[model samples]
Target: MAEFIKIYPENPNDKEIHKVVEVLRKGGVIIYPSDTIYTLGCDITNYKAMERVAKIKKIKLEKNTFSIVCNDLSHLSDYTKPIETKTFKILKRSFPGPYTFVLPAVNNMPKAFKKRKTVGIRIPNNNITLEIIKQLGNPLVSTSIYDEDEVIEYTTDPELIYEKWERLVDVVVDGGYGGNIASTVVDLSETNPIVIREGKGSIEVL
Candidate 1:
């Protein structure tokens, strides 16, 4: 069974944050809240945990296009190639919100994503997730937890998310109710910025 933890969105508890980070450091997968929705995440460096997440999501690791949620832009260049002036400007304007910018990958990423040409990057506006990433000291491998129901696109309630994903993940973080919408996906890998999916993040800056 997964460890169901309640973390306040406004002010996250350090003790609770430590618990989640410990789980992640130990190669455990977690269902945590993001700015837009409930997300499945693990430490990007943990290949075994990445494999577990891929299995739960029914995606092959080699063909995965999973996003990495960074705490800030400090280590952006470490995972991606040099950001062009225009692209950097856009990122500076839209980050710390619900936006996933697809950028060209660096020659050396984590082993699990070594062959990936591009990677999605996110710096969500949620405090709990940010604190968790801060404590973990690295970006998280993230993907939204989508619902199969005809009407609802993404799961909102944390308890329901926990119930559905308990057996599959090691931890389920209850950061209150999540949003039904996802992040706005922008492909900045090319010269012209392309809006792949329009969701919670506003397109005004893009």
Candidate 2:
């Protein structure tokens, strides 16, 4: 059975944060609330854990891509190449919200992202997720917790997720009902930002 943790979205308990970190450190996958939706995350550096999450989500490695959630811009350099000054300015104003930017992947990034030499990065404003990444000191390989048919799975109750994917995942963090909208995805690899998918964040800001 998966361990269920109830985290206060605004002020997560230290003990609960530690438990989530422990699961990630041990190569365990977790279902947690994000700024936009419920997501499945695993230590990006843990290849086995990443593969496990992919299997649980039924994501075909060839067709789907995953995003890496950094705690802040300081950690972005570790996974992706340096951004242009203009692009950096745009991200500065828009990030820490609900947006995912696709950038050229650094060589140090995991093979999963390196396979395409591009990575989607996010720096969410949520405290629970931010603290978890800060504690781990690395990005979490994450994707929306969508069903096999490509429907977003939004459940406020931890028991529901536990009932469905208990054996597949190691833990679930219940942070209340998520917004159920996805992050607005932007392709920053181009000279001009392209709105790939419209979600919670506004593309007009770009």
Candidate 3:
């Protein structure tokens, strides 16, 4: 079973945070809360851990693209191609909230995105998730934690998430209840940004 750690959503405990970071540094996969929902994440550089996440999701890594959660825009350009002036302005206003931007990928990012030339990047506003990434000193390759039950839709309760995913993952950090909705996906690949999925984020900025 995975370790269950309860972290304050607004003011996380550093000691508990350390444990989470340690697991991640050792290439452990975790389920943590994001602004939109509970998410599965692991060290972006750990290919083995990345593969484990892909397996848990039941998706082919080559055919699927997972979003990388960065601390801020500073870590973005390193993984993604240069954003255009107009797109940059739009992203500046919407990020650090509940939006994910899909941009052309840079060569340096991990090989999981090997078949695709673009990557989805997110700078979630949630403090617990942000602090974990900041302490880890690198971005996390992440995907929302969900099941296919039509009645359930998405898993938001941390205890239930732990119950369902504990055997498959290493740890579960409960940052209280998470939103059932997902972050609004805005793809910036074309000349104009496209709203691929409208969920929690507002559409005005795009």
Question: Pick by lDDT: which candidate is best?
Answer: 1
Tens digits of per-residue lDDT, candidate 2, 1-206, equal 89989999889999999999999999999998888888888988888898887787677654458898988898778877888998898889988999999988888666666567788989887899999998887789888765443464465456676788788888888887777678999999889998999999998878
Query: Where does candidate 2 stray beyond 4 Å?
Result: 60-64, 148-153
C-alpha lDDT of residue 203 in model 3 = 90
Cα-based lDDT for every prediction: 0.92, 0.84, 0.89
Error of 1 at 163 (Å): 1.0
> Candidate 1 clash total?
0
Please provide, for model 3 over 86-204, each residue's C-alpha lDDT reduced to its tens digit, 9 standing for 90 to 100: 99988889879899988998886677877778888899989998899989999998898766788877888899889898899999999999889999999998898899999899999
Please give the lDDT score for candidate 2.
Answer: 0.84
Model 1 poorest ten-residue lDDT run: 57-66
How many residue pairs clash per model?
A: 0, 0, 0
TM-score leader: 1
TM-score of model number 3: 0.97
Q: For residues 25-69, could you state the per-residue lDDT of candidate 1 as single tens digits?
A: 999999999889889989998999999988988989987778999
Mark the 10 consecutive residues where model 3 has the least summed lDDT: 107-116
